[model samples]
Target: MTTMKVTERVQGMGGPGRGGPFGSSMVGQKSMTFGPSAKRLFARLAPERVKVLAVLALAVASVALMSIAPKLLGTATDLIFEGLFGKQLPAGVSKEEAVERLRAAGDDRVADMLSSMNVLPGQGVDFGAVGTVLTVVLVLYVGSAVLGLTQGLLLNGVVQRTMLRMRAEVEDKIHRLPLSYFDKQPRGELLSRVTNDIDNVSQVLQQTMSQLLTSLLTVVGVLAMMFWISPALALIAIVTIPLTIAVTGAIMKRSQKQFIAQWRATGKLNAHVEEAFTGHALTKVFGRRREVERQFADQNEELFKAGFGAQFASGLIMPTMMFLGNLTYVVIAVVGGLRVASGTMSLGDVQAFIQYSRQFTQPLTQVASMVNLLQSGVASAERVFELLDASEEPADAPGSAASVSRGRVEFSHVSFRYEPEKPLIEDLSLVAEPGQTVAIVGPTGAGKTTLVNLIMRFYDLDSGHITLDGVDVSSMPRRSLRGQVGMVLQDTWLFHGTIRDNIAYGRPTASEEEILAAARATFVDRFVHSLPDGYDTVIDEEGSNVSAGEKQLITIARAFLSNPALLILDEATSSVDTRTELLVQQAMAALRSDRTSFVIAHRLSTIRDADLILVMEDGRIVEQGSHHGLLAAGGAYAALYQAQFAGPVVEEESLV
Candidate 1:
């Protein structure tokens, strides 16, 4: 086929584009080395092997058909040339001279075949044969295009479905992972893996996978056809392969490291953006905007350097390969012309060989470029699998029933540490009988929150048993145990939803009346009605439209709706004004009257009326008694109370 015809047929097949020495295949690729991660990726793709095989089959057929067109067009060229010029041989030419002249104009095969079927020196060329060849070329081109489009459509489905499942798996894996997994990782980094990295993998599957396969097949088909036509010329064309490899090897060795650095910098940049944006208000309040911007600029500069290095290196492959290919083309032209003049090859064969040479080298260039895309794809896959393979939360004990009747909770000799080197909680034991209010007060980092976490089974104790109603909390499914316990933390989280929806989050089936009752109990109903949308107003992410105290009340309403056997209020009302605090205190008193409650507070005034109070310092409880009893004893609780009442500075310094 002519270069124009071939170009049109392979346009969608990711053939070299116009004006670019290497085309997008090479330029857009990231790295050039597939690592062990590729094996796992292939294994994951194995289930779709039948579809992939079909794509390969279509690619092979398409390349094969296109390959045959060039040779056929060459034959047609010779037939027309000979028919027009055969009769014009010099007058009185000897038979041997005539034969040599005919042989010089065409290949020995075509010359002998035409001579055997001669019509006469003056007979016109066979237009019908040329028309037939043209028709077959048209059909092949059409068939190849149809197959290519079909393959693209099929692969698109496969790729989208694969990414869908992969994303879902990652999301599920996130839930299964222990809370500790999130403790050490930046939320933005994990977000990058789930989004950006997976997107890269999807792009490779959708655009590069079929192209890589077709390019390989085209290279092989071209090689076979080249050898069939003339082994000598094919060998000359093949010489460029080693040169291409050498150029690629030298450039990619440096570029691969850059690709890795680029992606790492990308993740860091994303993390910085997430933090900066999430805490923009705090950053502004603290006058740290300049510092945050500096950090961001540093990350951006790193990404630019790494990205430029990678692109600059990979970009060299195309132009360098193109130059070598052109050099090969020149050699073929000189040698083929000599052979044609020597009566061994035809003019048409020389033309076809040149076209075949271009076709052959194009795939080599494409495949070389594909190496980078494949490696980048594999790298992204590795990040994704890292999450999928992370340690999951330990499974709950089998056959254990979820039966917590009374709200009694006990922490029995619970020794725990976040890290092995530093023990945070040691031999801590506590018990709250049903319907008793147990208030825990502590200095910052005194393991008060850690103690509550153990009771909620958020983290398993290092060496102790936390039981709910005499049943080991670890034995029950985490979901079931957590369902019976309600916690309202200081950092009130409200998703982007209506005020009513936020309150009803823990009990979705709660009726409108039930929701309103809980909201009223927590005083959430006080301001909600003053808003334009009433309870239906959409809360922005982080509840930016609402005050912190309002957000805290909404969360309290949520916990109240759950009506769990056990309740935890961790500075739940610290944001409210005195009036609202008294209202909340009344609500808390009523709620705590029938359920076990653990109240952790920095403000000494909130839990003074508790049935019991435990004062903690340095991960150990230093004092425990009723509010009056502790004050009378002049212990840690009394000292904390005195500091708070004495002065704000003293209170801030004395309490966490």
Candidate 2:
């Protein structure tokens, strides 16, 4: 039951799914269980791939460029400090007063104000030194900004393209999938994968991956510059690298699992809401509003907790890394300052050490926070690949023609189960001549619908074979075989279009006169004519304006207009009132001429006129004859007939 429902929802997912710098490795082998079939699903987005690589390169360069500014500022401080605080510098006035005069001679703010890079009131600078510092900044800092912009644009492009490609492939898979796949999932659950899951990937791309690359570059570049300034200080700063990574990695790995659970729960929640809304009438009639609301509330709350848990946990990384990084920086700065005061290092070198210390921690902090983003992108990628890698039906046989007119159909020792353990049909064999009507009558779940499903090639049988004009359906093109079969279900589905469009659906080439002829024969023309625009009257999805019987009649009109060589009618008049049933029956009868027809009926009177009647039990045909022959057999069919049509002559008459 679970599998069948999922496959049904899967069919409705004939659309896209979502992901983005989506570093997700493959989900645990579910996609790969389909083998080489999965390869076709992740159609390569080469442009996105190129841009991702390009942006990563740009990010590295931008980080390197940014590291230059701190060093240049350090250089300006050293030059001015040497001039102002030489061997016999003014002692009583204080270092602050000495630095103030150096700035007036062009040492600038690097050796003044609240740490380096200061603005002092009444301070003046040599124009030449000011121009020199500004020049270096313009060359280095401006270069970093330009590179950052380029990387940002490219990363955005790559992420968007990857998502588009993923969605396209998932959608394509949906259309190509066998009908049975649809029975396995929910419509809304599948929808969430495309929209919500893909968006998660995009979010990572827009926010996380870029941060990760930039931070990684910063870490690398800052370390290099710190080494240039003071190898001793740089080594001290590197002490926390492994511990930081271990902490960040552990937090992200755990959150990845939570994020998956969160997304799955969110999909379930969406599925529940969709189910409630779609079956709103049932919920109201059963007075189940509170029940549905409670169910929704539970699922909604679960999503909230799971989502908040995943994000809240991931959010902890930045602050934790920041604190650890700052602690490391303070340790390095104090040790380096003591060395400078002992004359073991120059003031210029000490200034440079402090600048490099800032470079070390800040970049890694950015990198640490991006782990969460990377994890989300990866999780979404796994979901997308899951859909794409699902099993698809076999390709049409080679050398099979697209068009074939052999309209005869034969069933040979056929048996089937939606799943292996539960058999629905077994060892049933029958044949229908051209222009003959073969009616199959059985209780619900007796394989009446499964038999029709096999004929249309909607599913492959587990045992034996079905043939169209002696050609095995499995060996022929599925499309060619189905092209010859026109089916009408009890439930009529109408798209948002005109009445004429609905009738002409089967054959868009059909003329207005032909559509009218079909509608009139089905008695839909009567009601359609009553509408303001008659045949041109607009309809909505599922045809809300019409009665169930009227909708079914219109669908029958469409089938008639298509003029299929083989027609399958399942419960043709099952839902209609007696009057509408009568009208639809006339149309059904008209549609059966000169064609191979299969009728599955519960109303025995409708099948009495069929060329042959097969009574099925437990997936096999137990009785085969005319209506009277089966009635006389005194078997399961007879028992069922009497239970439904026994007692008195009037009771039997009521069946008519």
Candidate 3:
């Protein structure tokens, strides 16, 4: 399978517009491989068979009831025709005689009475026999309809339950996968699996059971009656079977590839639309309106073409089978008519064969109409399970610790890279003594964020050793590694809730006192108090409720409340206003006094006072010393200091 060079996920579903304007190409990616597990899943659907069976039974009964009434009328017509023409029968007495005799002798009172009433000439009974026949027919009709309604209720319940379980299973699979899995997927495509794919499966499930059951039962029952009445005509009817099947099968086979194309095109299209919406602000600022629209139009055109092809192909089978159905009916009539005249079959027998001919074709046509749609649903099901099969991070063994001691960190000969031999960090080594502030400063994309990400175990290093209190972070569980490391990141993400909720999110179990303490220290409490609701105020999704500066402080409070021994502040104030920056600095001072902290900052002035300053370049530490000592050496550290620190410093002596 070929792979796309994906950067970020757009959407997580498989639907139209996956590659709308910003998504990566969905081509050359892996296709879902169906296997034994897929068959097992079908077996899991075994219990749902009962619902299908009920629906089929109801449908068969309805069709059979309609078939029976037609023949019963035909039978009464024969008895009257014979009695009036040449036998021992009274003139103008045939209708009453047909009704009274059949009701008493044949247990077909309803059929006879209906035949006595006029229904339609050259069809069935007339209206005169309506009362007696209708009473019983109404009961049968209503009963069958009631069963059909019940089947609908049962079918819906089964489909809904199956989709619910499948959705939960898909969710668990998504979170279980390693972080790299998301890099290869678009959020909209993945989202489609949960929302659109599952929804499509729901529609198929709603109809399949009833359709399968009714068609099979009615077809079998009708063919059986036809065979009993006259094997000759029934045998002739079977010849049209092969032709009907070939037509339907060809339609299905052709539609399969088109559907697969439709599915892929949809994923690509969604990827683009998701990207457009997600980076809408960037697009607006850059004035990329025409460019974005052109991109969208390109992806959408591909989706529309593929979708139209699949739907158009699948839709034709219905009419083709219908045309063939009429042809089959004509052949049955011509062949059956000769047999009746030649005394080879009785009039009633000929009548029965005609009814069965129509009944039998009903199923073949129904199955023809729905088979392509059925396969599409199964194709989607296959995709859902394929995702469930993706590789995931190993679950941590039970008994893994979730606690931390006094913050102490050490990285020994640490090295990492996204690609082999293209090192981002080369033999990087550093130490943050317990309760000391160590700052790492470097150019953009110089492995600064990568270092913090490694500490959190977001990605494993190629060759490196990071430890906390002499314990190897790698050998320990990821949960254990992350539990001991707290960070205030440069990019602050807020959820839809109160400012209080955002801070408390770090440690949901933290007490109100701890939360307030963390907030007060970070100066978040000050702004929150300025607002009408204080800590009770609600916020928008992603912290749209506050300024970027305030968002940073709220994040600081989150880190503080977690109270991890090791704190990494990566550009905490780089994007904030000067006013909030000072408040955050004071909060940092309070947080770092008793913790071992690694501060990675671009603003040289912010970290110059750190106990140790490490100048990094090309993944190597070019200089390391105290701020004044490095400045005295007139090296890289001195140059970086000259670039950023024009502000008045609180002298070391005054701070001490």
Candidate 4:
């Protein structure tokens, strides 16, 4: 049940029209058990293991250097204080005058600390030593910054290359997936996995991976310094750690669920927008524009609520951490001041402890703040990996290859269904003699297309076998089988390319003469000559720039270029006008003259000349003969033809 919900939500992301970047939903997704998925992601980074390890080493070195600086600065402070009162002071100076002078020159706290130390009169300050310590401190900070920059540059290449490889894997996965998988998924949602989800993973790796490592190192290094200076003060700072954890854990618990809801809502909204935009004309024509808008508004409002809850919860982490940190700092100061006054700790030691306290807690707070980013990255990775792990089309058997020397196709007792319990095609048997024009006519849902799909091996049968030239088609590789068959679907598909390129799509090695000849044979040359660029004219997406008839002609030309031994025409001429349809039919008749062909048509008049007409009803052939022979029998085909040619009443009278 959980898997189903996750799959549905992920598959439903990025509604039809209002697509967006993954960041829009990042704050709203719930944290999940990304342990396995995250491990997989790290495995992807393994190829760049050397660079990654180098970056980690730099981060550790940088943190160690920076951590030591505060301690070094403290030593300088102790040296300067020693210069002030180390058995050497101004001549004839009373104790009160020295204390007042120290106060005027520096902090009162430092003055009191200095006054406690005995000083000899006429001692001068060592300004040169102070200058040396300050210069070393500057050098350490500069070196740390340089290491950070070098790590950043190397990390950028590692991240981009990893993401590139991941995207390539996903593209390959798409090709291996079954057509049925796509049939159950939305195109927009799948596109989101490839585009938005992969991009989010990239962002997280680029932005967070280094910070997470460096922050952790800083926290560890600073804590070591704190304990090394004064365990008592370090203990005081440690008290805030559990409290910070408890508070952040509680808040994240509340917000995590909201984030999940937020991302799911975003996906739903995107899916709706994608659907509405893709079918905008149909929606408007059906007066469904208002309904679509209402659905979108509802999904958007849900996202707003989820986003609000998530952001509000995560927003509380930083300020709460800061407040608790400040409170810890105050406690550390009071205790350290008492210890310093009693000479248990030096003024310089007290100052170093305070700095270390801030440094330790700062990285803790930063890591806490990164929880949302980490969660978003994991969620996106899970979505992408989920697609990669989906079921793929069954592989063809090894050494089962065969060649189609003849196009004699036959289906022997084929049985299949899209769903197991609901059978659509049952115990179907048929034959198409070599070079025969077999016309299959059926009403909607009568399995006309499904029959051809079986013959083309698009869907494997549950029982029996399909054969080409008396050999089982299952013995041949899919590519080899499809290579011998040419198809022109009712819905024409033309990519954004030149007219000549579109025609040569199936056979890229086709010569210019062959392409021009195919175009001429399909009557595509009629319109090609009228275009501004002629054969070089580029077609837009969906071929929207050209008329439907012209687009169909291009597809027909593509099929002609392939010149296969068998053809499947599914309502091939339905897009053309009467005159053009006649011309296309003539061309198809000539094309099928020597090749076995399957023509599925609704227009009874079109298939009257078929060598054999198979009239179908409810997934079975109710009658089979010539067009005249079926009419003479007065069965299902005769009734259908009569209803179309004569009035329904007259057809009923003739049937009775």
Candidate 5:
């Protein structure tokens, strides 16, 4: 029931790989590199400097408390050991007397071991001292836990607020981008950048920011504690640092490339899926289901390969780091045991040093594992930043002209092209006097729609100017120039809302009476009153509940409600039935009274009464006159009129 213009089909055939409007293939697009992207991502947090500083300070304090707790536990261990073994000594002997006696008895090793224990020869364990040390350790852990929780809460707030601002800026950028930009980019690709990529960026910030800071601080604190306990053991532990760095650095460098490829494949896949869904009915009717599915499978496989590479590379970090850490742990234990036996270090200090060694390596492992999230996040951030950095539409002229008083429109030597070398409309000149109905007729790709687009300033002229009521459209604010124009395209768009709300979209502040008047004038009232809910009937998301003709009528009502000075109808009757077309043509006739109207139609029957008829070919007007006059002159218009109405069917090429 819907007509597909030849021009539209031809345009669709040229997409992506076909060297159409999209220009280049997306196969080898490269994202920004990791170093610069990470820098930019962190720069976005500059506005929350206070919160970030607070989070860092809390991380430092928490790690400091947790780092000291293990040493205190070692103290408790010493107390219990001295208490348990002190029972072997002779009763009522002073500690110095027993040590001298042992030395006199030729037990020098035992005497020295007793000296290292630092216990009275006859004393049992001090339960009170052990209890006190354990109590202090418990308090330190609880304080560290509290500080960590507060830091997480503050960090979460900072990330959410930054994401909120980023989403708003992206939306504003979308509005400021030129229509030509959209012509080259798929809706799905842009949508993935706005939604999926931003969400990934948010997740990365929330998960990695605080944990990365804590792990780094823990490394510094634990290393300091390890050196304080015993420098030799600390040096043994530090030997593995260079090896861990080398392993992590190598894995991260390769994983980052795969991560970028993964996200790019994701965007391309999303674009394909969105296109398929939007055109599901057409795809099924044309029996292109298998082709669509094959394309999807191919893209899906690409995503899987890229994702596997990224994950496998990043996954190597944890196990390799753990293996290195275990080797360091074993070395530290053997050396510290020898030192304990030689009486160069106390049993308590050696125990504390072993715990510090584990703490030191654990943070390094943690940081290595977090590199995966960091790389993925930076990859997504680069995509979002690319959108933010895209070339925006030129700014409107400063102190521009405001409103148009009359609907007079003139295009003086206007020239433009979507591609620089392939001019679509060149040196086109025309005048639409106020209150005149100009009906333009031509075959597909004759630049009918392009001419209307120029008048509306959807694009700027490469050379020449468009004037509205003697005021150059470039000088006027886009909002002001577009405010006085109403357009009804062949495709009817309706959001999920009530019938009345859709009609009122054209003039948000219109009263109930004004809306009713527009509906009646556009024949929308005829259908609305028949429905059970009248004006309040809700349209579904796709607006599929209503027939196509009803949808077109509603759109006409919307434009009618606006009461714009200049009106444009582009194949507006192409979707409706013959009876419905009659109603639409009648409504359009009423709407055109006292208003300058530009109607582009392929149906010659519908425009015979137009005040002016223009026949265009190859971006130029080949003939122009009133409908009767053009036919009587027997030129291109006459041939087109004969082809449609009177003669034997003429070939489309011959008419052109």
Candidate 6:
């Protein structure tokens, strides 16, 4: 496998293009409802259902424990208050007698306040009882903390595992998708779905899952406790809930659209940046830096507008919730105070009821605030789901295996098109006998590369059949067919690795001696010997440390190492200088011995010695013969040759 071939396999297909199958229209559309997306997201957690249930149970236990502590603290407050007030009463006097004595002295208000407290006439500050109540409250709080911590840890494990599986599925899906799918999609936008969107989903889950559950349970537990203390006060405290829901609902409706827009803008911005950076040198050469910058600014502005709108709208929830909560607090406080003065409720009960009211509003506030995160998460989830739901290529035929012996290939009335409306290659047929060299020459978009791509099965035919060794290529398992073919394209791709490692990439188990022999055969040994690290010289990510010709040589060396039965050279020597091109040609000549080869070349001189030379135009074979035979015939090949070497020739429409 050459480096370009490996890149093709990994990236699937398609380079930077206009619009993808998942186009801008899809991205720009508002996420009207997240119900289905949320359902699908939760379904991914089905494997972790037991852990999720445990988290819920822990949340319930923790909230229950914490809720009881406030009430117990209220009891402690009552004990201290009752004891302090009891000291003012006469010693050894019954509570009823003391109250009557106080009433007889025109102290009815004081007597009424005393009746509300569970006080002994002779006692002062019951320290032991207060200490016991304080100890139980402390234990409840500690237990709640421990449970919360345990649940947090468990939830993290569940999330990490879920994300791991999600990433793996995305990777597998990419490999299975057809090359045409990539043709419509931008690299940066696809990457955003894979990396940024999925990461956002994970973050949203981490931040909201446990907290939402705990808040909801706290609300339920606290509400029950409030009602248990005083039904009227409980009712008053819950009055704000409808208003809270209405406010949150209205804000979230607007913010959800903005969140969707924000992520879409993020994808577009990332796409622009990736495209700009990848072709930065070209942009500079063309002096289009200012244009690129202007485009970037436009996309950046779009992202900012969307992001600001989302955050600003969601930010309204908290302050609005706080205001409603304060209103409820004041109402409850006033009501509880009047009830206490009337001797209908004790001081302890009223204090506990007030604490429950705060607890109730707090969780409500939390649930309302988390709406932003939920919307963001669901928006990202929809993007990821779109990727996962993309159409995949047809599955390989069952029990399909190609057995190649002499490398005979035949294109029997083959027809193919990139788009249904545009016929690229139609009714194409050819045969390359075992060990024959066939050269394909054509203008751009004349189906030269497309011809070889069909043989490799990078694409499937629209009609007819391509057979290798008398077996239909479509019926063969793609891997089984691809394993026998070696490819070298004009555009060389070298990954970040040592020269030796790159040469041995196609066959990782190749011996060092085989690696050296392949490198030497490709004229790579001459260059390697001059470098400090020789065969171990590391290539940077961009392969910038090496010259363009050197990168091309390394890819040729990789093809040589693979020692394939069928060879493809797609303008493989286009990058080298004249002197180096001679060396590469000699190397390719040696490599082509006894192997069937397809060489697509723009340079006519390189294919003059080929057994068969085909001249293609408009996806059809205009001429085919030896160089001398075509030159003598004075046809399209002769015209192209004349234009290259002899002089300017009158160009016909077919030639153009």
lDDT of each: 0.78, 0.72, 0.71, 0.79, 0.85, 0.85
**Across residues 1-656, which tens digit of lDDT does each residue of candidate 1 receive?**
00000001111111222211111111122332454567677676776889878878888888889899899888888878766755555546543566667689765654554453323455557889889988998898889899888888878877888888888889888888876666656656668888999999899777777887788789889999999999999999889878877887887676777767777677767766876787777877888788877877887898899888877777777777878888998999999988776657777788899999999888888877776776567767767777787788888889656867788888777777766665566676778888888998877656566667777676787887888888888888888888988899988889999998999997999999999999988888899989999999999987878998999899999999999889999989988888899999999887777889999999878898888898876445778889999999998888888777877876777887
| Model 1, runs deviating above 4 Å | 1-33, 90-97, 100-120, 648-656
Residue pairs in candidate 1 whose N, alpha carbon or C atoms collide under 3 angstroms: 1-70, 31-372
Superposed Cα deviation of residue 280, candidate 3 (Å): 2.0
Positional deviation of 601 in candidate 3, in angstroms?
1.8
TM-scores of all candidate predictions against the true structure:
0.89, 0.82, 0.81, 0.88, 0.93, 0.93
> Per-prediction count of colliding residue pairs?
2, 19, 42, 24, 1, 1
* lDDT by residue for model 6 (1-656), tens: 00000001112244435432222322333453777888889799999999999988899999999999888988998898899889988789988888899899998877898887887898899899999999999999999999999999999999989999999999999999887777667778889999999999999999988888899999999988888888888888888888988899899889988999999999887777777788878887888888888877888899999999999999999999999999898898899899877778878888888888888999889988888998899999988888888889888888857678888888887777776665666666788888888999977656678778888887899888988889898989989888889999988999999999999997898999999999999999989989989999999999998899999999999999999989999999999889999988999999888889999999998998788998875445778889999999999999899888766445554478
RMSD of 3: 8.1
Q: Give the distance in Å from residue 2's predicted Cα in candidate 3 to where it truly belongs.
A: 37
Query: Which segments of candidate 5 are over 4 A away from where they belong?
Result: 1-28, 94-113, 646-656
lDDT string, candidate 4, 1-656, tens digits? 00000001111123222333221222122334655667888799999999999999888888988999998888778777766665455688766687788778866765676666544455655678778988998999999999988989989999999999999999999988866676565665667778878898899888888888888999889989999999888888889889988998887777766666665665666665666787888776888777777777877898899888888887788888988889988999899989887657887788888899889888878878887776667767877877887888778766656766668988887777766656666676778888889998877667787778877777788887889989887777788888888999888899999999999996899999999999988999998889999999999986877999999998998998998888999989889888988888888888888889999998887788898998877556777889999889999998888767887778788899
Q: Give the candidates in order of TM-score, highest first.
A: 6, 5, 1, 4, 2, 3
Q: Encode model 5's per-residue lDDT on 384-448: one tens digit a residue.
A: 89888888878889875566657888878777776665666666678889888899998787768
Displacement of the residue 25 alpha carbon in candidate 4, Å: 19
In model 5, where is the ten-residue run with the lowest total lDDT? 1-10
What TM-score does structure 1 among the candidates reach? 0.89
Candidate 4 lDDT trough over 10 residues, lowest sum:
1-10
Q: After superposing candidate 4, which stretches have Cα over 4 Å from the reference? A: 1-32, 86-121, 647-656
Distance from true location, Cα of 37 in model 6, Å: 1.2
- RMSD to the true structure for each prediction, in A, is 12.4, 7.9, 8.1, 6.6, 4.3, 4.8
TM-score of 6: 0.93
TM-score of 2: 0.82
